[model samples]
Target: MFELNDLRQTRFYQDVFAEGKQKGRQEGKLETIPQLLALGLSIQQIAQALGLDEQLVKQAAQPKS
Candidate 1:
């Protein structure tokens, strides 16, 4: 029983860590949109290169408050 509980906890933490890593990668991609645009890439091109939606790329290109 103790071993099973430990294994569940470990799996839960591993899943959380994986999700965090994915989120970090997505944020990093969003951060790069401006630079890619500056380099003369269109919204569609940036989205294709980043494997993201064109709307997401356009949203990221918007100025922050």
Candidate 2:
């Protein structure tokens, strides 16, 4: 039977874990865009600081429509 430790050692599990971490980090960065904007940072500055694309930052800045 597969144990919890065995599952963690599998390639698929590792890949999924890594992907989740990356996605979480990206979401966190995108969520921060508004607060940074409130603090007077430009889209370019936010993109440079967050290591994200200017387009992504701009999209994040857009109103929900």
Candidate 3:
């Protein structure tokens, strides 16, 4: 009695996926931030390590001051 029709929640799926992606991005930042800081990597190096754009890395690396 397993029917695929029971899984008709498109919005729910989207929300779940979005949340997962957001959490993953946060965790990745948490994991990479220290490496970047420890190595004293430039924005470009940090971006390369994370396979992200240098601008994105720079934005992420901005000090909290």
Candidate 4:
């Protein structure tokens, strides 16, 4: 039988895994921002099309250091 501490650790790991998946999905969407921009979509338009924040889209459009 699982102890309480074991159950808590399992839940913590599950939460972390779920968060990683979500971040990966967001990164994938961010990676698409430039392609959408190349297609002539404005930041606002891209955000609306992708259901992302306009600011986040703009940041993604910027060249990375």
Candidate 5:
């Protein structure tokens, strides 16, 4: 029987887990932009610190439409 534990042991599962982890980390960084801005950090500074593109930082700072 292919149990949850068995599924978790597969290469595909591992790859997906890694991808999700990276995405989560990226989202966490994006989420922090507001706080950083409130702390008086410029968009350029945030982009450099987070290793993100300046355009991405600018997009994150904008209010969601």
Candidate 6:
């Protein structure tokens, strides 16, 4: 069972939630990588800047070309 508590009052919960949200946003960005690459972004460039795999970048570029 779970009860709704004021987790926000604790610094630990706040940090954890913030970190989780940041990670979620990062994952969302990764999901959109293909779309971003389709918009004429170079794979090497994307890979270098985003720290993503070049092969993944290439895959993303494929749908556009």
Q: Clash pairs of candidate 6? A: none
- Write the residue-wise lDDT of candidate 6 on 1-65 in tens digits: 33347666678888999999988866775777776666877778788878878886666556553
Best by TM-score: 2
lDDT of 4 at 38: 94
| Residue pair clashes in candidate 4 | none
List, residue by residue over 1-65, the lDDT tens digit for candidate 5: 88999999999999999999999999999999999999999999999999999999999999888
* Residue pairs in clash, model 2: none
lDDT of 3 by residue, 22-63 (tens): 889867874686567778777777777677777766666666
Q: Rank the candidates by TM-score, best first.
A: 2, 5, 1, 4, 6, 3
Query: Native-vs-model 5 lDDT?
Result: 0.97
For each candidate in turn, the TM-score is 0.84, 0.95, 0.54, 0.79, 0.87, 0.55
Off by over 4 Å in 4: 1-9
- lDDT to native, each model: 0.93, 0.98, 0.71, 0.90, 0.97, 0.74
Per-residue lDDT of 1-65 in model 4, one digit per residue for the tens?
A: 87877875797878987999999999999999989889998999999988899899988999999
Q: Judged by lDDT against the true structure, how good is candidate 6?
A: 0.74
Model 6's C-alpha root-mean-square deviation from the true structure amounts to: 4.8
Better of 3 and 4 by lDDT: 4
Root-mean-square deviation of candidate 4 = 3.5
Stretches of model 5 off by over 4 angstroms after superposition: none
How many clashing residue pairs are found in candidate 2?
0
In model 2, which runs have C-alpha deviations exceeding 4 angstroms? none
Error of 3 at 12 (Å): 5.5
Q: Between candidates 1 and 5, which one is better according to lDDT?
A: 5
